[model samples]
Each structure stands twice: as C-alpha cells, then as structure tokens.
Target: MENPKKDSKKINDLEQNYKNQENTTLTTNQGVKINDTNNSLKAGERGSTLLEDFLLREKITSFDHERIPERIVHARGSAAHGVFELYESIEQYSKAGIFTDVNRKTPVFVRFSTVAGSKGSTDLARDVRGFAVKFYTEEGTWDLVGNNMPIFFIQDAMKFPDLVHSVKPEPNKEIPQAASAHDTFYDFVSRTTETLHNQIWLMSDRAIPRSFRMMEGFGIHTFRLINDKGESHFVKFHWKPKLGVHSVTWDEAVKISGADSDFHRRDLWDAIEAGHYPEWELGIQIVPQEDEFKFDFDLLDPTKLIPEEMVPVKIIGKMTLNRNPENFFAETEQVAFLPGHIVPGIDFTNDPLLQGRLFSYRDTQLSRLGGPNFHQIPINRPIAPANNNQRDGMMQMDIVKGQTAYFPNSLGGGCPHLAKIAEGAFDSYEERIDAKKIRTRSESFNDHFSQPALFYRSLSQYEQEHVAEAYTFELGKCMHSEIQERMLWLIAQIDEDLANKVAKGLGLEVPKSIEQPINQAIGADADIQKQQPPKKKIYLDKAPTLSQANTKFDSIATRQVAVLVAKGFSMKNFKKMTDVLEQEGAVIKLIAPHGGKVICDENMEHKVDAAIMTTESVLFDALYIPGGKKAVESLKKESKFIKFINETFKHCKAIAVDNEGEDLINESFVKDYKDDKAVFINKTPEDFVKAMAKHRNWDRRTIVKNIPV
Candidate 1:
C-alpha cells in the first residue's frame, strides 16, 4: 500500500540478508564456534593421535556422509580383479604371509579413481587419481589405499575436508566439473603452504596420465613393518607399472575429455578383456628404526618423499589384474577399503594424517556401505575365517548359527575363540609412545618448499615447461588479484624462472611480498611466523625417477594405433604394419569415412572400428595410413580426417605413412614434419614399432605449436 520505491528497497534488503555472508562468522553445523580446524589433536607434536578429538570426528563424519552410495571424494572409479604373486620372500623384513610366502598367489581387487569429481564426471580430469588395492591374504584383508602421487596436498588428515571443499565445485554455482582450474582451489592452496609439495605435482603431467596401466601408485604414508623377531622398521610402498609411466598433454587432455570421457575406463576394460592384462611390480623402501631421522626431511611427513636416489626401491613381487569385474554396481560400487585392515607384520605409523585415516576410512565405509556389516559383502569378505561375536546392522547378509552374540560365553562353548600370538593371530606393533596430548604438528613438517623445489628442478625441460603452463592456466582463472599475487609469490619461492613464466602469462608481476601470514595451519594461539615454511632448500640436484622421460620404453602393449583407411586401402601396406603391431600387442583400430565394412585394393572386405566423425585423434597413441590412391582421394573429401591427422601431429604422437598414404599426410599439418624423428615415411614396420614404443615424440612438442587443427 506504500510507495513503490519503498517496496523495491525492502525487497533488495531481504535479498542481501539472505544471500550475503560478508560479516558472518564461521561455525560448526551445531553452531559451536571453532578456533582451529587445521590440525587434529595429537599426543604430542609428533606423537600418535588421540581419539578424544571431537572436532575431527564431527568434521570428517559430516564430509563422509555428504553423499549417499557414491564416495564423497573418489566418486568415479574403475576396478578389476587381480592376483599378487610374490617373486621372492622378504622374511627378514616382515612376518606377514604375503611377504614371506613366495609360492602363494594372493587374490586382489584394485580400484582406480579420480578425486574432486562426481560419479558422472569425465575420466580425463586434471586431478589426483586414487589407487587403492585390497589384498585378500591368508592373514586378512589388507587395504593399501593411496593415490597416484607420492605425496598429498595436506600433511594432516584434519585438513582433508577443507582441501576437498576447496577443490570441489562451488556450492552456490556448480559450474565447473572435474577440474581444479578455478578460484576457490588456488585460494586455499596459496594459504595452506603445506599443500605446495603435492600442489606442484597436480600441476604436472602426472595428473593427466595416458592410461591407468601406465601410471605409478604410491602408499603416500610411512608405515612400520614388524619382523618375526619383533623388530620394527619404517617402510614405504611403491607400485611400478610394467607399461611405464606416461601422460597426455594439457591440450590433448582437454580434447580427450570431449571426445571420450571414458577413455581410461574403457581402455582398462578392453585391455583386460582382450587378454592383455596390466601388471605392476610391488616395491618397498625399508629404513631401519634408528635411521629414520637420518634424512633431511621428516619420514612422517605426508607431503614429502624419500628420493629414490637416496633409497632404491626393492622390487619384491608383481600384481597382475587379469580379470574385469562381473558387475560394476555389485562389486566395484559396494567394495569398501579400510586402512586399519592390516595383518600382524604390517602395522600403522604415527603419521598424523595416517593416524586420522585409520579412523576416517572405517567411519566412511560405515556410512557409505550402510553399516558395520559391510565386511559380509562378497567383494569385501576376508579369505581367513572371521569368527567374531559382532551382531547385525543394516544390510546384514550373514546368518550366525549360535545364539551367543557376545564373547566369552560358555553357552556357545566358546567355539569362536581368539587365536594366540603364535597361531598367525594379529598383534599390534608395540611402539613406545609417551607424550602429552596436544593439537599441534611437529616442526619437522614445516619445510614445505624444499621438496616442491626439488621436484620442479628434477623434471625434464619439457616437463618443467608443462608445469609452468599449468600454473599459469590455473592461476589465470582466479578472479581475485590478491590470490593470484599470493600464488605468484609462493611459486617464486620454488623457482624464479617458473614463477616468471607463469607471471608473464598472467600479465602480472611476481610480488615481492604478501600481507597475509603464510601457512594458516598453526593453532589459534600458536606463533604464525614460526609455522611458516622455510626457504626452499636444494637437497638433491635432480631425481631422475621423478620424470616420465626416464620411464621404461621396451614395450608398447595395448597401445591404440589408428589406421586411416577408405574403400580401396592398400592391403599389402596394412598387413605389413598391422602384423608387426599385433605381434607386439598393440591394438589396431580402423578409422574410415563411414562405418561397417570396406573393400581393400585386393577385394577383401574389412570391418570398420569407427567412422571419421565418430572418433578423435586424442583417443589413440599413434596414426598410420596405408598407400592407396582411391583411399587418399576419399580421405581428402572428409575434413575431419585432415583435422585428425593434424591433431595427431599436434599431440606429438607417432605417425607413419606409406607411398600414396604420404599424399594424405601432405594434405594435413603433418606434411611439414617430414623430417620428424617419430614421423615415418615408407618405413619398415619394425621402425614404426620402435617409435611407437617410445610413447611419443616429446621433442616435436616445441616445433608443432603453430600447427592448426
């Protein structure tokens, strides 16, 4: 009834009140004001964590239950059934049967996943890959849940929720999917200096692996191995892929996401189904208990790794994933892994992050898989007899025979009794822990910049350039100038050249100083300046193992090779090339102008794998075109064929053409690269195989920048 202007003003005020949070204080869902949420409550600065930490429980519980059925972090996953065969017994290191029994073929289930994405997100996301393995040994089910990166963004498990929240899509506007090139992620990474080590890893090509079979897996945390003599030694786990480490370029990753969002998932399933099983050697780096403090960095720090140059990996066994899951929802979806599921010889360490995970993983499964009875699921059940007195809950699939639901009951004749320590029973490692309970981290974990600097310096020239470009792209997306400046300043601490490269790309200067206190992981009353990361140190000149350039290149098994053909493709040239390729276990896919069968020059009809517009160049590892005048003429009419060849050259993949096939290459951007080392012209099939085995012609990346596709 009042003036119209008054009504409009009232409506605007209401909108601001409901949407804006400028002056609001951060509080828990229960309305409890929190002062420090970065570090969990521990026994001492570096002692074992305490269970009285309610803040950690509440925050992680909320995060674990945020989504129903699908995992909150590693939502989109692909898994397989495998078997682990020990090559040699390491009886001196551990008493675990899997480590000591060389004749045993332990059954295993492995799940590979991408973090910071939903169940429906694209597989080619530039994000951390989750590499979790569940080993069903005679002792028990040991779950070695880890990631593709050797380190993580945060040091403590307490900040895991915060880390995931920052990298996840923004709540109000879920615009970006399966990506970290956004504002909120970098804002958190810049403030949390501990994240710098693993942050540099995410900015590298390792985040965009070419295939799940080609990427390495890491335990990421230090664990203790107790021998039969009760001696404890600190150890780290590594999984070296038999196919070697490989990755795609950022440009290729972008296009691949559009072309085949299920590239990795499909590749893995096809390889296993085609009898080309993926294999990875299990390796361990064992350090004596007395030698733990010998390194420049803390062994317990989750954000650092012991350089392989210092301690070489001792290959013990191999794991071969020879079978695909029968049902995705029943096996892959409902499978639960718990870090606490360890045998007698394998035990936990006091790493704060690992300490928190022992609780977090089990808690997450309780909520995700319905209840405590999830272990009864066929995929999660242990091989050894589970004679516990535990009772029913949601989704209880087991039926107990006796009426005794409690232990130490004579009514059930105490039949489900515990085994003695001598009868292969599990025993916790008796590590000494005498310290006061406190909510702080050790000073040893403060040197965050040193390892990141070492990692950047260790990379090859091409890898380093990719890192710079990645940083530039990620930071350039940030709208806030202050956040970008802060990141530029931090990157400068790692390397001046890298920082300058990113800064130049962003059209901004690398600031000499930033106003905010660096490293916000300190407690509410702790000294901020003391917790700040120290100056970057150069412990080693380079770790060659850090670069994919030094990976194995002896085989090209399961490599997808695209054979461009038409109605009159050269059967002679095709046979010569494909015979050698198939012998080496490379997959040959025929791409033509149209689908279905096409007749060759010899009047033989062959099936088509994909049509010109139906497939993309980024989906294959190499390209081959057989010699045929009619084939070249038909290929020239299809514009996508030319674009496909141009993209193959742009990505620096191997390319080979024979006789008139060169005519097709001449029509595309590959014509200018006649002298390129990996671009073969009328070459022998052995020569082409040799080039394809190298994965890609990385040197060609520098000169092919101007190629239009």
Candidate 2:
C-alpha cells in the first residue's frame, strides 16, 4: 500500500504539472526568466513604474487577480494529498473499483476546514470542522463531504442558510468572526431543537481537537451502496484516526489561538512534511434496507447518528495522507468537493440535507470557482479520462476534439458513445419511488434530545463537567436574556444538572416551562406544541463508544514533545529521552532560552528549534526538562520558562524531568504533587512515553485547576 501516490497516474499528472523554482531564475507569468524581479520597470531609478513595461504589467496583473472568491462556508481550510488502500474487498457491499479492486490505489485529496469561519478565521475556533475527501477512483471522483462529528446541526437543507447565518458573525456588527457564542446562534439553537445533537458535540472537547490528525471524520448522511447483485444497503462512513481522538481544554484552546492561530493547520502540514503522515482506518456501518425501520431514530435524518453499539463498524480500509500540496491556492484552495460527485456503486438516500447538498454544491462551484468549468481544474480532475460531449464556458481549459458535439450522432462515426453498464458507465440505482411530493417533517425525525442525552450520559464525569462549563461559557456570552433563558430551558431537556450549572453561571433560574413551542419551527396547519421535539426514548442506555475516554490510547506517535534546554544542557539526559521517543515516532523540538545553537554539557552544540519567548506550552503535547546544573540555573532566571511549565502542568500535559531538571521543576508549580501519574521525576523515558500515550492525566486536572500561568 506504500507509495500509492507513485502508482497513481492522477498524482503523477499533478507532479508533472508542479513547478519548482529552487535555484532557478525568477520569471514573469509569461515564462520570461527575469534578472530584475526586485526592480519593477520604471521611467528612472526612483521614478514611478512605467505602463509601457509589459513585465511590470504582467506581474502586477497576476498579483491583482491572484485572489479568487472564497467558499461561502468552510472557508478556512488546510488540505493534503493522500491515497486510500483497501485491506479487503467488500464486493458484497459495493461494486466500486476502489472498493472491489484490492490492487488499485485510489488517489485522494483531503481538506480540513472550520464551518463558521471566513477565509481568514482562526483554526482553533469552537465550531464544526469540515473533513471533506475527494477520491480519484477509476470510475470518477467520489467526494465524501462531511464533518468531524457524525451528526449535523440541522436536518433539512432549507434550514442550512439559516443555520450558517445564525452561527456566523452578527449581520450588522460582524463581531466574533469564527465563534458560535452570540445572540443569533443561541436564539436559533433555543428554538431549532434539531441542532442540539451536534451543538452538544460543539460544547464538548471534540470541537477543540488537539490536532487534525487526532480528530475523527464522519460521513454524516446515510448513503447507499448498490452492489453488482443490485442489492442496496444503507451505509455510513467513518474515519477512525490511527493516532486516536484527543482535544485540548478550552483554556488551552483560547491561549493556543493567541499563541498560534494556525496550530492545527501547521501541525497537519508539519506532520506530513516530517514523514509522520496522518492515517485513519475507514469504518463502515452498513444497515440493510429491510432493517432501516429497526432504529429508534430515523436513519434518513441527518441530525441523528446510529450508535455503533447498534450496528458494529466494520473496518474496511485505511487512508494515509502522505504529501503536502505543492501550491496552496492551485491545489488546496481550488479543490472543489461536491456531495453529488459519487461513483457507480455509491448512491444517495432521501435525506433532505443530502438531497439539497447534491444541487447546492455544484451551484456553489459556479460562483466560487468562476464557472461551470471547475472540473477542468487539475486538483478536481479525475484519474479516469473524461469522454463526454459536455462543452465548457468560463475557464475552459480543456479542448474537446470532435466535429459532432451532439450525442447519438452518425457524422463522427458514433464518437463519444454512451457507456453501457459493462463498460463502467454510471447508472442510478433502481430505487422504487412511488410517493407524492409532500413538504412536511417525518414523525421519525422528531426525537432530538435522546441522542444528545445519550451523548452526554456516555461521557466520563470530567468530560461531562467540561460540557457543562462549555454551555455556561457559550450562553454567558449572549447579550439577550430571553435567548439565554430559552437555551436554559432547552438544555434542561438534555440534562437538568447541566442546565442547572449553566443557569447558575448566568444567575438565572432553569424555568420549568418556557413557551408553548419548544420548537418554533412548525408548518402552517401543524400544532405549535405538537411540532416540539418528541420526548426522548432510551433505546440503548449507554453507547460507551460515544465517549472520548473510550478512544485509542495505545500509541503516542507524532506527539510533539518539547525539550527545554539551555547553553549548558545535559547531553546524556537529552539523548536518553530523545532516542526512546524518536524511536516511537514522537517529534521533539529543542526549546532554548535563545535561538541559534546551544552547547551541551559535553560542549556539543545543538540547533535550537524555538526560543522560550517564541513558543508557548499550549503548542506542545508534553514537556521534558533534561539535567544540566548550569542549564537548569539559566532556566530558573527566565520567568517565561517557569510559566511555560506551569501552563503545561495546568493544561494536564505530561511533564518529565531528570537530575538538575528536577530542581527546575521544584522551583515551578510542579513542586506540589510531583508524584502525579503524568509527572515523571527522575523516571525512565519509557515512563514518560507511557504517560504521553494516555494523552493527558485528567485526574490531575482538579488539583491543578487553580494554577495560574
């Protein structure tokens, strides 16, 4: 499965088109290599630029129009090139080439984004993350446009615009660019009961992922897989990260935003560039069409997720992102993902949101990508050669060669003939539809609180506390008292205790009853009260899988371990820890008092990765202080070094110290309870590695909660 990109003709095509300017002369857009790139053509040495200078015009013109229209949503994004390899062919499930052909390496481009943010928004925003993947399979591109969470905020596509509007910055002020805490968002969530499931996830730790590599991805909709036998099965796709799901605390998240707004983006890019590529195991939850009605929650509802306990996830394949995009704008920015771009075996369901997305995505590309010829963009182009009579308009990069452009024409000897089922032509599944069109909510889509309640209940006590605190913080940000009150009443439906905590924070009571319409979204003839979310019913008491506590903690691969060092550092202590950690795929960066090189105890010089003032503790997963009498003495003089360790301790990150390093820790907040599980004092590197693998020592959180950095 390795070097999957090397075998992919599409990836090869991109590599062929990719240009490198290293050691080459600078050039204009017209490819005339220039020796005077710095000095634009001018009338005189210091005169104004001359309009007669074609080189200046060409360079400035390209720079002026370099910016294209950004996406309306999921605007802030980072992407990578990857390949998907199947472990076992699921011929019974899907007949798609990527699924059935075990030897085939499917090229893919993955884009991770924040939903509420604009193009310039911070990556650490508390909002939904878009995890969209475009697979260049033999048939065509299959774009699995999804989010980190399995469920979404709204179920109906018609309400999507409203959801985005409310969650986005306020209309008049445009305040709070990338955040969800505001009057409009709270107002919408208070009434739109369907949003509770995903909004709860937003309030939880999942929203603030430690790294993009650690976040789980999901295809929220219930898509279908039609096999060669013409049997259709309902399918849900899941990407379980190899590094495991993990997140930073809200306090850390805020600090990280200030310290490094591009934390996740940088992490993802650095990981790939360092050869510690991100990988995720593909899992599928397949339910037969006959068993669709068996679930308590509607399978077709975009707001609900099928508990993995009900139908176990089958690990099918693995997707490894190995390459960083050569050009951000050309590859990552211009990559358009459409939910409608599916394969022969894969088909859509009647999920209203998915249905609307099918039309909306293509329509969006017309404006965002500058026209209907978006597919001609190299990133969007498929490995499979496109042979069709469809002509293009704007940005028409392709030149279709044919006298007879019309289909079924004899003049061109039946050129561009239609493909048959055997020739791998796409044919829609023969799904029987025998119902009149009606615009109304399904009775099955009404249970909004059960899954949300289930999600809350499945969390560990500490996770639940975080959720409660999140609710309090978000609601406390709202300006309108009525909006906060409505949200309190809504939260009460999910958990009375959580509601009580949030209400207490706002100095408001959790009212027993708020209004007639718990859900204000009702039809013209429907009863306002009747349209309210149905009383939650517990089908399964606890889906332990829902909890982050249940996620993988087996390995600490690619975990960033900050090694604090100084001019007279302990080479022995440093190498001892680094050797073991690097063997486990952990990356250690030397954080010194100053930049450049620092001499060790052995008088050996080492390159400093970052200076104490340049980096923050929130940027690292763990901290290591090596033993050196002079080094520790130097660290003691610097106040920021102590604060760094203090913040790391407060954030529940693992901290390891040895020899004189113990003296440095003793001078800081680690002086108290140095015996904590995650605090390794004079312990072996193996002990620190084990502690780091656990992600964090949440049990130590209560004791260190009051630590100020």
The TM-score, computed over Cα atoms with residue i paired to residue i, of candidate 1 is 0.96
RMSD of each: 4.0, 16.2
C-alpha RMSD of candidate 1: 4.0
Q: Candidate 1: give the clashing pairs.
A: none
lDDT of each candidate versus the true structure: 0.90, 0.85
Q: What tens-digit string does per-residue lDDT give for candidate 2 at 483-593? A: 788888888888889999989988999987787344423444444447475478898889999999999998989998999999889999899999999999899899999
Question: Which residue ranges in model 2 land beyond 4 Å of their true spot?
Answer: 1-68, 516-521, 527-529
TM-score of every model versus the real structure: 0.96, 0.89
Model 1 alpha-carbon miss at residue 146, Å: 0.8
Candidate 1 shows a clash count of 0
Q: How far is candidate 2 from the true structure (C-alpha RMSD, Å)?
A: 16.2
